[model samples]
Target chain A: MPEPKALPFSARDATCPFDPAAELYELQEREGLPRVPVPSPIMGEFEAVELTRYTDAKDAMSDPRLQMGFVFDPEQPRTMMNQPGNLLNYNGADHRRLRRMLTSAFTVKRIRGLLPKIEEIVDSRLDALEAAGPGADIVHEFSTPIPTLVICELLGVPYEDRESFQRRAKIGLDVNTTREEQIANLAEMDAYMGRLVAEHRRSPGDNLLGSVVRDFGDQLTEDELTGIGNMLLVAGHETTASMLSSGVALLLQNPDQLAVVRDDPEAVGDAVEELLRYCSPAIALPREAAEDMVVNGQWIEKGERVVTSLLVANRRIPGAEGDLDVLDVRRTPAPHVTFGYGPHQCLGQQLARAELRVALPALFKRFPTLALGVPEDEVDYRTTALVFAVNKLPVTW
Target chain B: MTLKVEVDEQRCVSAGHCVTSAPDVFDQRDDDGVVHLLDGAPPERRHEQVREAALLCPAAAILLRERDGSA
Candidate 1:
């Protein structure tokens, strides 16, 4: 196919780092969707028309004609990218079959059950941060470890084996990595998670993987189990970690908002929604148009690829009471597309929400006077990554 | 005012946004976590929450229709 437009868009804004690239918002106001090129090692390269408006983004996503990603091919050897159990890899009936098997484990009620554990995890991380006594990297001390440890406990993956999965998870999400490197990392992850699945088979624990094994072991293939295990590990941790670190960075820059998050017990829930909507950590997967469809009056032909800047959509969301560009924690939450929309919407969303609700407030409450340990511009932000994040967040209380 | 609700169990990926938005009107199936509509035709007071729940549903599983209620 002829290469689409050369209108490649940067994911981040130069001036306001919390927002999507300014061009995306500009594109939202323009006459039509622009064809944007996305190059990735795993899926090679593809050109897609971006849907920037909130209504368009939501409609295009939930529309049945626009599929999640490539359909899972049973003939192909299962890799991290194309596997049986990973819901992101399939569409329609096949997708529902895999997703239903684990839905019980990720329900809002099930996730709420983990609140005590999540609270414990958050407090321990705060203790580590306090002991380090400021000038510490919150990425390391607070953000990264909380979700990592939470997923570990939830999946029954040995926390000691986090080293094996964490590094590869980062490698997998790095868009700059080569195909060979990605393939090698995928294999390593496959084997690592495969062992964890095997371990669960022998004696099922009360965690997610354990519960799946207990209920659906007869139905699930080994590859499916491994895929589900690793998908949760990768999807569950890094996104939340980035959100935590970046949200903290965003909050710290706006002290009044930070105060709202810290002092107000009833407002933290509202605050996390604003943070998710404002920061927009999860970059949505580029979608393939399964059939010709019109999104917000723009005609998209069949076989076309479509993309979305979720950050822009969140900011442009209709019915929001205040300025979209500014951050307001106490404002009523808008229905943002941060967790994405449609059938492939994030499975661990409730768990992620619960984690942030507990973690973010607890971090600030523990250290009443937290401030950036380094110059504002000195903080390294991970912009080009699949998940927008902070490389290291240096802070002092 | 009566708020009538319908849910497509097939479409729900169990994102749980519906339940979060309107817990009294919606719930999740314990077995599959798909949406479980607790109140199909709710009273006037619940109309707003139920509307919010339908809008917030990521899967777009919840659909709402309105009809005048008879006292």
Candidate 2:
């Protein structure tokens, strides 16, 4: 593969946690693929296309030619345990059907109804932090607990086993863990979810897992349930938890932004939207072209694998006008591709929003003087992480 | 004239930008993840934000029009 030349722009280098678009856009100009290649052993085997331009990325997302359900060979580096009929590996009507069923669970009203529960979870976790006194790692003590507990509660996973479940969830994403270790963690989670579902089947609860089993009992096979459960575990917990830790840290680092959020709690909604756009946690997911298509004069053939960087697309581009990159909550109408676009956008977006809305404001309301416990330089940025996050975020109140 | 907004469900991507922009009038449903119009018209004060939502609707599904007793 030929390396593309860098573009002439001075955006934040890839290292800057605040704005990493400069380097990303440069890669976009380079042969239209981000220089940071998708880490897949099958790079030579598959035709990899990188969609970085705003129009191209959005087009790729909405294009019917792109298949969402294509499962790369399991031997590939990023392959998870293969389960047939999982939502991630479906396209067209199948994708639509699964999305319809799951989207309902994440509706704003449903999520809003869970606000009190979300608050309880956030506050209880915060209480634990306060009891532990200063210098507590907020990521482990506060951030992880809220979402972990929320997912467990939502999926009818017993809260008693939460700490262990949280440990397994983290290990599931640990790069340091050998592939075998990761696979083991996945199997453990699957088994736990399997047992939890079985218990729910014997005596159904009001949570999402029971609902799925009840409504789609005949439709969802055992493996399907496990796949959906695992999807929820990763999507329902990791994304929200990462946002809480990193978003709060970003606000703390940018005191001006934090002050804006503090002055008017109403800004929490806007701040959360901005944070989604700014951080764009899940950087790239593999997408394959279902048919030949043209995007911005570039022709892409069928059966091609393309990765869209929502991170870079959310930021300002050289040819694009307006402040797409700026993290301004007050922007009258913000346009962000954080939750994604088209048919497969985000099933849990409203739920994620609700979690953020409740958690961020509650944190400030409880600890008005909250600030980062450690210096910004001392903080660890999950740079190589697929889901942008921090391992530890210590905050002082 | 009482202004009203409508989202063509077919074109709607369930982005919930409408809900975020004008939560009082537009809310997403807990089942099937469809957008529900809470009120025909938001409070007169929030009319501006609603207008902004119509313009920002990527799918162009949201339509804003003035309503009178006789249409």
- Which candidate leads in TM-score? 1
Q: After superposition, how far is residue A158 of candidate 1 from its true place, in Å?
A: 0.8
lDDT of 1 by residue, A56-114 (tens): 98888888888866766767644556766777878888888888988898898999988
The 10 consecutive residues of candidate 2 chain A with the worst lDDT sum are: A3-12
* Candidate 1 collision pairs: none
State every prediction's TM-score relative to the real structure.
0.95, 0.84
Residue runs of model 1 more than 4 Å from their true location after superposition? A1-10, A73-79, B68-71
Per-residue lDDT for B1-71 in model 1, tens only? Answer: 66689999977889888888788888999899989889898778888888888788887788888876564
The prediction achieving the highest DockQ against the true structure is 1
Best by lDDT: 1
